[model samples]
Target: MDPFFLYVYRKLKRKCTKELPSCSLCVRLGKTCDYDGAASEMNVDQQVLLDRIRELERQLEAGSGGGTIAEISAFPRQGSSLVNPTYTIHRQGFASNLYFLDPESFGPAGVPATELDPGMPVPEQVRFILGNRAEVETVTESYYDTIDRWFPIVSRKRLVARLTTFEPKTDASVALLLLCMKLVTQILPHDENPRTGLYWICHQFLMQVEGAPLLSLTLLQATALMAIYEIGHGIWPAAILTVGNAVRLGHIMGLHDRDNAHQLFRANSTLTGREEERRTWWGVVVLDRIVTMGTYDGSILTADVRNHELLPCTDSDWDSGNIAPFGHAFASDLTGIQIGHWAQVCQAAHALGCVQRHRVDEGHAKNSRLDEAQQLDRTLVSLAASLLADMKQRGDMAINDPKQTGSRSSVDAIALCCSARFLLYELYACNDGKSNISRVSSFPSGQEAVMQRISLQGINECVNIMHQIALRLLEPQQHSTRQSPESYITYHAGSIFVTHALYWAASECSWIVKEGINAAAARVMGDLVKALHLLNDRWHRAGDYIKLLEREETLSD
Candidate 1:
């Protein structure tokens, strides 16, 4: 056959085998034909290459199985020191230099430890665990720069001093430092797994310190940080457990008893140290209540008189290198950014917790749930008036002031004030569709009826203020600007409660909408969607809510 004819014949034969209708030659001459086999051989060659690559990977894994941790640490980026000796890891090869990991770190369960003096610092004892210095420092700096502002659990000066100057490694401090780093990685962009190996290590360390002979102030703070970590990661059950443990630990350390704290101050402790102890206890209490807000349950801290101490003094006073004046009374004259807002939040929590306790009461108490709710409402009203008064006092100068813009804490305080009021309304008005109190039309008889009217009105005001704050928070300056995850989460914490109220208003309290109320259900829902969309990037929960609203829309359609 001619060369061109032969090539054409082969191409036609291949096409005929792949497609259906027989080739012209086969149809005309009634012939059976064979196709070229080169494609089959090529596929075989590719498969062989892939198999070889996988085999080599398996072999490499097998070869590394026998290497000691110290030898493995010798490999580039294979090791991380414990960073604190008191938090001893029972494993080796944890501190890899990688910034992003795919699946899992070789945790304590899987790895063998390198022999070292048990009393040595973790950084000196373990060779290859944790992470590199630069990565660790980045996470540490990111945390202090962001989350620490709201919580103020760690003192900046003290943390800086610890990082700069060498100090004896303590389990509690190291656990807290590790948690701060973990939180930063979670909030910032590292794109690692949600539960990182670093988190597991910190968790392990915290577990080890659970029953130590003496639980220090630092230890209680560390426990609280762990709860924040769990909250940020969406681990509610674990967060609740951690918060409960922290509260108990605080009591064990005598943090709740002012007398015990005073004794500590008498025994060579600085006034600042005692204040920090006080602040940590309050931080634990506030978080305990905040995390479990909508469940209508009281916090573990309880409404006991002893549990309520003076709110923490100014952050400046707590962070001071020298002893500063400590006032147990609520300081009304302090700036919004000062410890005053923190006090307001704490007191508001106390009041709300009181209401929840009353609601859950079994009628064994002298006062009815309605009576106690009214009283706590009064208490919260007083506190909110103080916060608003402070704002009013600073209103003229504060309008264009950077403090209003930059003070996330103040924004949070105002939002909490609204939430406290909103929650009190819910306590009386939320019927759960099965109660005698019809939230829709009728109110309780007489005094209860009057209070319900006031609470309903209060709900309107609270929702309106909440809407304005949400708008301000979701404004271009706040949302568009790059920020840490903590900022968005903290902001959303306040707004989520508002969203809950709007949900109730739109569904059950449609009469509020019918009456042309200040916080119209439809209007607030629209604003909430816009605000949540803006926050969708930093907080996934906002996006989740948006999806929920959309789904509800779809279902209605």
Candidate 2:
């Protein structure tokens, strides 16, 4: 009956049958019937770790006099089981560090094992539904061919390397990731979409893995892929919840600290796992912003990316498994910088966060935020310069590959950047705000009108940008060679990851049609909707996007 203990149980996701002394579940597990006693013992070891972390922090602060410069050394990373973990942290110069998450203490998992396959040769049920070994190989290859090129969250070579050491019956994390890859890549019937089949299997494994105290990069990648399924299918609330947990894991593992001054040159200065970690964090950030795009809500990426948060490593080097870091950070000066495709996507998502942040700003009137908007627009323009140039030379579909629209492998990044600018412009210009737009002006005159007029111009430019992207998506692919061949990937239109960009543009332009601002923009929305219809076969959420636009069209009519 003690609510505190009940809350703890709920936080740990244990269902208490309300049995006296110990809940039925606890009774079955032979644990103390909690709530009425010193139930804190349930997580006493976790507290010990926390207390040790605090002590370490205090010692670090006292030693470094509050400096954030970490002493770079060849110590083992957190979570490794060591009889004695060593960190040569004390150095000749300034030195200190903050442990976002200390490694898990050495112990078997508190919960039971969740065997995904449950057999040496893979269970008949799993093998029948998912596939046999060779079929699984095809599905896995398709995953890399389809989503991974754009999302680039999971490392294929790394996963193959890791799976080589994993036992088939065990290794739930890898299993979950593989299942998710199949769920997204393989075309299952509607009954097998979410709860009825593969999605359900992955969800159960995710719950088990997410519960067992939750520490593992493999699980993080697994969650991201599953959440992609959720977002792609328009599975609300659940999508956001999944992305939120992934963000939390990202923060806990210090994935967001890649370029942080405190975490620099750490991880033994070898890019061993750092490349995957860096790419995963960017994927996490992009997904966090993307889920909110469906509702035109604020981005969920709470981690403030600094100007120095280096963008993802070069695409070419990453694919070849080279460990060289990218040339430049998202450093404030983004002028004429030649970055990779995925880096552009990362920056676009980061800027979308900034654009969405404007909606939640309550300090000043919307008009007062014009300077912020202007600066953001300028930064976005600088980023889009190369993309626009590429589009100019090569028309809409840059490469012969259908999935790559704007400028080959950079299609999703181009889409995201266009949506960012479109939403930023529509934030001030569009009359409708509740649905597609982020905000509507309460005070609709004078300086507000001036801002709206300026936003209208920006919106037009965004429309022009959207037109090019739409043409790339809507127009048939040409067998031309004006642009270099994209041998790196060959993603078809059916494999585009998130339709957030296409959805966002259509939503805004639909309102532009309703308001009679630019009737020509209607064509652009139609083109985007057509593309979404083509993609609906793959994601199904594209259908949701089309339905929303149709509703608007109906209401306007």
Q: Give the candidate number with the greatest lDDT.
A: 2
lDDT of 1 at 406: 42
Instruction: Give me the overall lDDT of model 2.
Output: 0.61
**Candidate lDDT values, in order:** 0.51, 0.61
Model 1 lDDT at residue 130: 29
Steric clash pairs (candidate 2): 21-33, 22-33, 79-103
Give TM per candidate: 0.65, 0.69
Summarize candidate 1's per-residue lDDT along 1-557 as a digit string, tens digits: 32223433554564334223456754443233336533433453454454445545545775655444221111111121132132223333232211014112432222121221122233322122324556556656766555665666666566565566533243335534555455433542323344544555556555544432223566677777777666544455777788888877766444566553212112224566656666777788777666676566544463343533567776455545453565555433333443454565666666656655655665554335456667767776666666656655644114233224443345456655566666667655644445433432333467666677778777766655556655655554454554653455543334332343333333332445455554556666566556655554454444555565666562131
User: Where does the lowest 10-residue lDDT sum fall in candidate 2?
Assistant: 89-98
Q: Candidate 2: list runs displaced more than 4 Å.
A: 1-132, 188-193, 258-269, 296-299, 325-327, 365-368, 390-408, 430-446, 477-498, 507-522, 554-557
For every model in order, what is the number of clashing pairs? 14, 3
Alpha-carbon lDDT of model 1: 0.51
